[model samples]
Target: MTAPLSRRSLLGLVGAGAGAYLLGGCSGDDSSDDPDAPQTINWWHIQNTEPMLPVWAAMAEEYRGAHSNVTIEIQPLENEAFKAKLTTATQAGSPPDLFQSWGGGVLKQQLDAGLVKDLTDDVKPWVDGLLPASLQPYTIDGRIYGIPFDVGMVGFWYNKDLFSQAGITETPTTWAGVLDTVRKLKAAGTVPIALAGKDKWPVHNYWAYLAMRIGGLGALQQAAKDGNFDTPDFVAAGERLKELADLQPFQPGFLGAEYGSPDGQAAIMGNGGAAMELMGQWAPSMQASSSTSKKGIGDKLGFFTFPTVEGGKGNATDAFGGGNGFAVGKDAPAATIDFLKFLLTADNQRTSAKTGAVLPTVKEAVDAVTDANNKTVAETLASATGFQLYLDQAYPPAVGQQVNDSVAELVAGSKTPAQIVKDITQVAKSQ
Candidate 1:
């Protein structure tokens, strides 16, 4: 039940948990007049914020300072738009020198299409130092291809204040316990959980966790990759989600809520409108970004592995998450490769951790995380007994999209488990 140290981890988490991707230069051509001077390394990422932006900018600046000849240009893009644009750009052979990518089938698609550079030799030193599971997804056909900059997982982020108010002393670790807590919280006039289904991908997180909890990692992977959506295991997992929904567990109108919004699902938990949230470690930053949003947010935000169902094949410690990092494009210039190595150094990894991105890949850098919450995240991932790449990311691109739409339909109460399975089975068959 050890976390699958397979090639799916890197791709699964990013596509499932975050809705962004690094594409080609959105402006137009590379436009570097230095045909023989120095390579202009282009980086596409979505963390274009105050502190996050400054950190990446500094890394770029410092990288340029050291390399002297190379210039790193970071272009930020809107999440959904970037993914679409990147897909188009990559197809047209205009991919950036090195761009950010989510792990799993997303990266695999590019790998299958020969759009990304194979970095087996380049990543040897880092690979030797990484935990096996962490390195699995970035590698293909025995060659490493990408570097993990930052990685994190999704779990139950709970408001301790809300829990105490509901007379709940222990964090729930089983399906029954989760139900009990929801009932108690409701009696106390608080919604038990907050979930944002509007973005669709966030909804897939719950489905993946529940499927892993019920069927185990290997089964989920097989079903996801093969489109075996009709299995009893998948149906059982869908039922668990419905169980939570039946309890009136989610915040009011959560189905239509915004995702990645500080005031969305996390906001519901932050304001005491809900007792807990099924969200990633990034929830804190969103919660703390605004003055009003900071009301009940605290170090007391307790976390627990997604609860398990009795007799489920998946173990309690098996969690869902992955990493996103830069990989050289197939047509990258030699100078760009040199610049990329500079960005992957231990020092830069440490700087990225300080930006609130959880669990950086560098051994030395992640070891230096002083924040208790960050430390907990590192421990949780390390201690996990089993893991699965997020379902959508683990499957083919077409299947991934179908899974997202299926889960969204299930959550919206428009599709039954049987119908969803049949629908996805067709998608899987087509692939």
Candidate 2:
């Protein structure tokens, strides 16, 4: 189970044991030697809804117009659909020329199967121009396999009016303060938080962030390396989450709710049913769409980084989140890489950001994040001292599923904090 890596190597230990399940694809010679040679590139992404959908279509159209000899075939699928389709394609030794990638253990798996291109040389000189933190998740084994168009972090997305109603003038900056704020918000008759226990992945975030804040990034890597998560700091994080759980701060039936259902976490936040939710950068748009009004809180929405843990080794700058990017397939033509670069340009990044659906990975495009909530996410990412991909995406499938299961039980009051840690350790050791 032990693996050697560099830099953010401590993160995204995916598919270390699944190598036997993957088959190698044929080495591609479909690429053209002439830069302007006529070719068709297959592009796949998972932005299937409005705002982003039309935006991508326009970008492809623009690219086609610029390169008259090039024909672009674009396919936009929903998130789950894309994953299923990609799994089928890669298993058959065929994948789109360029497709979406989240760049953690998943990227590691793709690389292991020789399904991805090594972009280190192709993107060099210019890749360094992107933000340092934004590049962390995409880099594996000291090489770049993908390019990030957006980068983000997880934090508290709150409603200004609800906070004001609860007499919370400022967002909590420490764990203790957050506990107090939740107490106040609950006392004021507002559901302090919204959670989706049915979707165990979201339940994992609280435990993950608390552990990062208390144990620091090294502690996580150390556990991952040694297959031991039964430590004081990890237990202490679960204890703190238990403290909040004891307050009964979440909306009723939270244990059964889904992430995007009518009564889900985002809907509760959008309809002002809950005071806040701990979510990623896409929280705002999802909330708006899922809300009954389709016009979420609008200006009433705000965001703040996860609170610091008092006396903890980590600070607010250590972030926990992942973002979207494009990875070149092994069979992709050289022109496919060029198209990816064109899509990530600063000017083009600005266009994507203006849709209020993305936060640019390129430093020059940060200014395009004019929405107040989005700007906060971008600023927080800009100052990140450390990063960890989402636990589900960062670890092997069996281990990640175990993490989600253990966390969900803890949230549901079925497992003790200590028991949860031991459960995770057992799964990691088995892996």
Report the lDDT tens digits of candidate 2 across residue range 112-181: 8899999999999689768776677679978998898777777899999999999999999999999999
Candidate models: Cα lDDT each: 0.67, 0.77
Q: What's the lDDT for candidate 2?
A: 0.77
Clashing pairs in 2: none
Q: Pick the candidate with the highest lDDT.
A: 2
RMSD of 1: 4.8
**TM-score of predicted structure 2:** 0.86
The digit string of per-residue lDDT tens for model 1 on 1-431 reads 00111111221112212333322222323445454455566677655433355576676777666655565667765344456678798889778777766556677889888888888876665566655676665767677777766666777788888899889999987988888999999999987888766667767777778888888897776875566779988888888887777777777778887544555664666565667876665655544542254434777677787888898998888878766667778877666766666766778777767755445777778766766776787799888887666566567777777877887888888998778777888998898
True lDDT of residue 96, candidate 2: 87
Candidate 1 off by > 4 Å: 1-36, 270-272, 290-296
TM-score: model 1 vs. ground truth = 0.88
Clashes of 1: 7
